[model samples]
Target: MESAFSGHIYRQNGQGVTSILSRRVEGRLMWKQRIIGLHLRSKIDHSYLSQSQHADTKGKSVETALHSLVGHIEKANQYGDFTMVAFMDIEGAFNNVDPMADVEAL
Candidate 1:
């Protein structure tokens, strides 16, 4: 079978070898990305960093963050305390980084 990503032909043994190989490649890529993400996130000083790529982190997505924020607001309202919120979009902030530099930094 021909691999769509690599454009290389792979031998099959009637056991979905192509599918297995593709999944293996994807797993390795995810692992590498996770390692790089962890290394970069370590430099952040904020204790509330909730990047979803980390294996141990939960409630790291925007939906979960918003849910937590709403929970906080509810708690503050119940206690008659002032609540403040600020949201910033840092999208594409790391899109310009060089892949080679990241590998070398690791």
Candidate 2:
């Protein structure tokens, strides 16, 4: 169920152009992302990221999240505290990205 972009570039004239990237360029981009992920992981706390988003975090699923939530809810109930949860579905969350900004930040 992995979704990937087909590297298609669209023009103002409504023409679609397929951009083919060489393996070398693709590998370099992947390596850069992996390095960035490693650096971020070292600087940030692991708990701040969703388990599935990182590489080192394995054997974690939605069930694990639910179990943790239920345990916290039970503890809160024992202490007479209220628990609330919010869910958000954002469409096209990753569809827009400025590559120049990312390169500059790096």
Give the alpha carbon lDDT tens digit for every residue of 1-106 in model 2.
7648555454343455433455456788778767765764465566776643523555766677678778889999999999998756577553345544554565
TM-score to native of every candidate shown: 0.42, 0.39
Write down the TM-score for model 2.
0.39
Writing each residue's lDDT as its tens digit, candidate 1 over 1-106 gives: 9755765456677675466566778899778777877876565455554452333354366667677778889999999998988766678656556756865664
* Clash counts for all predictions: 0, 0
Q: Which ranges of candidate 2 are over 4 A from the true structure?
A: 1-57, 99-106
